[model samples]
Target: MSKTNQVKEDTKSVFQNKGSRRNFLKYSGAGIATAGILLMGCEDNENMVPDLDGVVNLGSGDVGVLNYAYVLEQLEAAFYINVVTNLYRNISDVERTMMEDLRNHEVAHRDFLKAALGSNAIGELTFDFSSVNFNNRESVLATAKVFEDLGVAAYNGAGKLLQNPDFLLIAGKIVSVEARHAAAIRSILDSDPKSFAGNDVIDANGLDRAFEPAMVLNAASTFILNKINASQLPTS
Candidate 1:
């Protein structure tokens, strides 16, 4: 197999073992609660249905919050998958491993949300990273930082909107992972440890910033090809 293919296989294995263990640990306490989510996903409820009229309405209530997260995971997963497949120039061994790990983790997140959402999940989203210079290490890492930070904020903001305790618990777990990814990317860009939790994203109280669904979606719109409607999402 080619080197790229070999890398893909290695990452897949890592995800199966390491990623599974990590997510399992985070989810273990909420197993029964998560199972409830799966049951909810299986149901064909009128309120949970999105109008497919050329736009994806993220549905409503807890399902809406989930689909919102699903969209972000899909974007992050796609970006890292591309970065791994088409490695940047002069990439180091450590960087390559980091990329692979990030890719697999995002994929695992995307797939888990998809499975949890079941039929209630939105269709696959299409992304446009044409502007990203995948061949350049700086460009790739910068974009990664953007995606990771955005993912962390999106989850933080949406957590309050979820009424289901199980869903909120899972979202909190996922956001913690996303924050780690953000910090990793930040550290890579600037060896300064402070950059990992810079003042830009963290307040004086040392709390991470959160962006509401609309704000998050707006920031992410530059790369997304599909028009998403979050109007039906819960307000309070």
Candidate 2:
């Protein structure tokens, strides 16, 4: 077998042995209750009402930036939640726990934006995962790695566009968390736990990757159903 195939086999063995539910349960310990709590008061608030189901325009300025992050977080949170609900075959308790934590973090990020954007937030988006094989552990982890990396890159690239200092600070904080998630997923995908932030994502300058908003949205289009019109976003 080739080196790449060999690594995959090795990763499977490690995943089965190392990931146990008890180990993951120790972190955060925030369960479904916490998720529900974060979304509290949203239903009653008139401003929390979602926009139309069709193609939504992300208005310009700081609000547009918030919605952009919000849209990505929605995707991440939904993806993780789906993974937790329909876990892959042979999933270890440790892996399950890790997934649960990711779900909680994504949910927190998603709800935070939802609450912050209030009336400005776009309606919830629909997704299409036909290309993703969720039942395959490798496939699911690979997809998660992609989403996490894209999220970090999106935040990093968006920093210059945000006019509000407070919004930029918040983005910085969330991007760090997204980076951590990306690292954790990368570590789990291989035998080398130290491979958390591999060279694939970090450049020679040791900088994490970044992408233009349009490019990020285009890549995300495969899984997202909405026609995201980013034309109105601030350029200066």
Candidate 3:
């Protein structure tokens, strides 16, 4: 074959491969969307958000609480995945294993919330971690600390807002795991076991710090690029 013709054939082959890949992705995405819609159909409309943004909108009551948990889980899951993806230099094997465990835990939490929420569950959230320096250990751990601490406080704060006893029980279970992750991350920075659980997260009365949904969402909004309009979440 002529050299020119050979080059043209190669280009055509490349284009065909690219087109196939693009089509595959498009179909995969469509399948996921369809499944999500079907899942939403099973839930009570009263509990589901009427509109979904990049962030979830937890309408109210038990549904609201589940959405809230889902959002936090999304954040944690994203953060740890980032850590694993861009591993810092000089990271110990033990540290890597522990962080992997944390990553799995966050995934489990996110999945649990999604399953529990059923049709009432909010859509997937977009995370923005531009401020996080994945290359720097300090920056990564600091952000992890913030997320872990916020998660604990979020559950503590939302506990009272939960009307369903089963939902509250689930929250308690998830938060305890979050607390353990926080403690493990804190130990990486300090020898003190109680470093992360100090007065800031724990009040003078020995109670865990709690924030209203608005307050927790406000803090969370800073790290999340996708703005969430959680005004619909029940305050009462």
Per TM-score, the best of the predicted structures is 1
Q: In model 2, how large is the Cα lDDT of residue 171? A: 82
- The total of clashing pairs for model 1 equals 0
lDDT of 2 by residue, 18-91 (tens): 65634422222232223222222233333222344576777777777778888899899899989999999999
lDDT of 1 at 232: 87
Per-prediction CA RMSD (Å)? 8.7, 12.8, 14.2
C-alpha displacement of 58 in model 2, angstroms? 0.7
TM-score-better candidate, 1 vs 3:
1
Clashes of each: 0, 5, 0
Root mean square deviation (Cα) for candidate 1: 8.7
Clashing pairs in 1: none
Runs of candidate 3 exceeding 4 Å displacement: 1-43, 52-56, 191-194
List, residue by residue over 29-124, the lDDT tens digit for candidate 1: 223224434326434556465567779878888888888998999999999999999999999999998998898778778877776676788899
Please, what is the whole-model Cα lDDT of each candidate in the order they appear? 0.81, 0.75, 0.72
TM-score of each: 0.84, 0.77, 0.77
The TM-score between candidate 2 and the true structure equals 0.77
- Higher-lDDT candidate among 1 and 2? 1
lDDT of 3: 0.72
